[model samples]
Target: MPAPATPEAPAGWDFSDVVGSDSSLRRFLHGLPGVDQVGAEARAAQLGTRSIKTTAKAFALDLAIRMVDLTTLEGQDTPGKVRALAAKAMRPDPSDPTCPPAAAVCVYPDMVADVKQVLGDSGVKVASVATAFPSGRAALDVKLADTRDAVAAGADEIDMVIDRGAFLSGRYLQVFEEIVAVREACTAADGREAHLKVIFETGELQTLDNVRRASWLAMMAGGHFIKTSTGKVQPAATLPVTLVMLEAVRDFREATGQMVGVKPAGGIRSSKDAIKYLVMVNEVAGADWLDPDWFRFGASTLLNDLLMQRTKMTTGRYSGPDYFTLD
Candidate 1:
């Protein structure tokens, strides 16, 4: 049985025995129940078709805005651009102060300080993507350094991608150790560690079974959140894949009494799509995961769509995309 939570595993459960060795880690991961692709897909499809009342739609729209990780991970991202993004995150609808701010603003590590400056005391978190980012191809030291630099720069959260190559090649222990190491690197000099969001890049995992394994691996290795994608890969954050992940977290909480957040980054830009995810979270993971602290969307354009939907719901007319800041 898993041990109760320790200082290392702060989520109220520890899996030291499961990760004690390469053989044991592999055995436990492989022993996990396989995914039923057909059922998962059908369930996700059915959930996607379920409609909420107008009041709930309004609530979901605001909740989605609050759950957004308003991300910009391009090479051309500038400090000024990040500041504007941070401003937008702080006040998503300036005209409508009733509108809720976004949960966080995600950028590359170098820009975490800029975001922090703009978001100071706003309660909006500064999340930086580290560990080689979209491609987790760097060495262990390089990845840890990347994480430490971001935390040292005042990042509240670190989104690190797991090495898909190591995972696919059966180097489960290597991947686990890397996640654990990066989790350690999130600590600052004063002792506060940024919450670690472990991205599986599930599209490349190539199977629902792999998604399930990756979820457990991340949670077992002490990731505060298990994310669906890095938002660079094609087919990022599909509903079926997210369903599998939600199921994993639900089962995990039951077994270990710890709740891990889920983030479906990329390709989820529509308000309708975001609401479907909210519904699924309620059904699969229960109401606890419905909060912004327990769920997030890692999209850049999703905020605009949510704002437009919120305006429509309140005023009975849809706001054009041009109405909001393009950034």
Candidate 2:
């Protein structure tokens, strides 16, 4: 049995356990076999009615190029780091024209001001990872406050990590509650809802089924976006894992008519990989979500490849990724 919808997890609660009193495990298990075929072709056929104007050919490069503006470019990546990101965002280099369509420039909460300044008038949003990021182990108040602070700092979006320890311990309800609360905390900031992307660190979860379940859990808990990995873990993003996630997104849409977003982070080092993801998204989600609004890639080094590919397609010659550093 899972804990009721009160924002509290026992000192040590367990959710995925069949051997526990406080958890959604029994329920989850009972419902497992039903979702097993979520990635099947039959599921895709169901999505035909949900199709929008999205297609890989049209939106692959755009989504691939929408840089998350990782603030880690500089060591003490504080407000100054955000400014530096903005500078890089605004720099006009002949090698990389059009700049990254400026997906939310990710930064620490404290640097929201600098990111805002750097991205001024460009419509690029600012996203901040919070709530003890890469590890959601913290006092609820502390985590909520951190998320609040980020939004107060002008973060247009929030990326938060779940407590893997708790989740792995069979505590699905706790994970669910924490994410919901953080979502609330983010929305409370800026006197409106700031977008929230929940990072599941699927690599740590260790199975495509768990990844799919986690994706569903996040969506059910109100995550506007279900993201993979924190980019801090190895085996960040993989085709099989992402295929599972997109398949979940497709099912959730069929069940609720809600279209949540998908972001694959970590270790995607080349444009070709991005294109492959694009292929998956198109094949899975159909053509309606080809816009940058619903899709994103968390990458620091993938941009040059996207540019190179786009350039090659236009100019009919291969350009090295280093071409971005030149003119």
Candidate 3:
């Protein structure tokens, strides 16, 4: 089959025209090229087998380490726990200062201040999950308040979940407006708005086509990054789902000249699995997206594995799992 047509936004594509009404947004979203489920899965599986050489493997491992968003989003999260996580984010390996810090440390809004205290000037960002994260079922006002609170607490990035009920039920405009509002609520300190990461919880989306549409929808609404899952759902961040999302961001930039990021969260545990994602990003989204800013792995346990691999590669001996803190 011929490659899918690019939903390249028409030159000078105006956001207002598309979001002017439910009908307009629906028409544009539904008209986008349909996803080929079989093709996407086959491509993801094929790319997963590509091998990396020893030298490149070392670099890719470190790059993957840097791309990780070390996260601890639990109901029992305390200031002490948040502080420890922050420490780990800043220094994945206490023994080696060469180990680059993770891209950010993600936590609940209430823990942002505690994390900030530990990560001060250390370069590890404080990312908070807001807008009724993991479950975007609350009212719009409640969600906006949640977002504002996180930003006020110095969150560099806000991860908001979309109202899947609205999207699946054909309330695309409502979902669009919610994202727009949450993005607005992401106030920044230095005149730069906090980056907004829109989470689709792909497993809940049910199909590759939905993933593509949701990815486009989030980007169009000003999401700095489009994320796969909240890690609370089953089958989160599968390679096929991530492949579809990467394609959306690639095509979006082609049309709008705007670069959006992609994050595949949850279920990615080992260094081997993380490297597969790196290969996919390089192959599917191009080399420009290989950086931590353009892509991320929202994970808790992934960092530890990357540390272990790095240790083995440098010391020529596998430092058993106990060598690193249990993230």
Candidate 4:
């Protein structure tokens, strides 16, 4: 069970007027209303039925393109691969210049420098996965160093995985404090703090209730964005999971007057799936969360699908997989 909430506010959000004392934090998280799985799923399914066509489809395609964090997180990733992916991000469809570039290219920490070099002046950001990435088992010092290395290497953004072990075991304070420390480490040498994205690996969190709690925890701990997965886990980024997170961000904003972005990574492969997610964002999180700055899709193959659909929209013909370059 989670701890209780205290009356006093924690130091982190004193300025924001959201008192977050340890007991209060626990009370807030644990006291959060439980998720109704059936109702939430029904809502997502119903929203998925919203038909987007013609100009709306065109707009969604472009918006989805701009919202993509075109990712390549393989252990075997090379500089050559990174460059190819960066090129894809800059010009998703070489045949069509109207297609906007993806939001950023996500990679492992060690590849940030190479990605930054390849993507110079393209306006596409470089995001690195740190805080032990894929797994949050490292010591705090090691995690901080990992984050610092990525920021120093020119990562425009940092995606850190929370210590799920600690979180599930009721160590919310440890999880919160770790995020605060990493948020501090996001400060680059140039005095700009790289955007911090907290990934919950929601697949392992087991329930929508936990996803909601984790989302609130991440936002309260100063996550500029809350991500759904690392793309390495099974069941990585599901509709229900992302829906729960969207609601969390929506409520967090209503309660605290702060806006945080949401990223649903992994398993989202087609334009249809992407559009469904957008529908949910529009209806559940409000249209204000529609921009790339407020939302992102951490995806690889989803780009090709968007490109193909865009081609169909333009030429009235579907392009084959051979037409789009592999990244």
TM-score versus the correct structure, for each prediction: 0.96, 0.79, 0.97, 0.94
Worst 10 residues of 4 by lDDT: 1-10
- Which tens-of-lDDT digit does each residue in 1-327 have in candidate 4? 111222243333442332255666677788887888988888788888999769999999999999999999998999889988998899898888888999999999899998899899889999999988889889999999999999999999999999999889877888998999999999977898899999999989988889999998898888999999998898899888888888888777766678899999999999999999999999888999999999999998999999999999899998898998887
Give lDDT tens digits, candidate 1, residues 1-327: 121122223345678778889899999888887777888888899988998998888889999999999999999999999999999999999999999999999999999999999999999999999999889888889999999999999999999999999999999999999999999999999999899999999989999989999999998899999999998998899999999888888888877788899999989989999999999999878999999899999999999999999999999998999999997
In candidate 2, stretches whose alpha carbon ends up further than 4 angstroms from where it belongs are 1-26, 34-59, 67-75, 78-80, 90-100, 316-327
Off by over 4 Å in 3: 1-3, 188-192
Candidate 2 accuracy as TM-score: 0.79
Clashing residue pairs for model 3: none
| Model 1 ranges off by over 4 Å | 1-13
Model 2: per-residue Cα lDDT at residue 124 = 77
Task: Report the C-alpha displacement of residue 208, candidate 3, in angstroms.
Answer: 0.7
* TM-score, model 1 to reference: 0.96
Q: What is the C-alpha lDDT profile of model 2 across 99-185, one tens digit per residue?
A: 455566777777777888778878778888898877677888989999999888778889999988877776877888889899989
Candidate maximizing TM-score: 3
Select the stronger candidate by lDDT from 1 and 3.
1
Report the candidate with higher lDDT, 2 versus 3.
3
- Model 1 shows how many backbone clashes? 0
Clashes of 3: 0
Better of 1 and 2 by TM-score: 1
lDDT of 3 by residue, 20-136 (tens): 999999998999899989988899999999999999999999999999999999898889998999998888899999999999999999999999999998888999999888888
On a 0 to 100 scale, what is the lDDT of residue 268 in model 4? 91
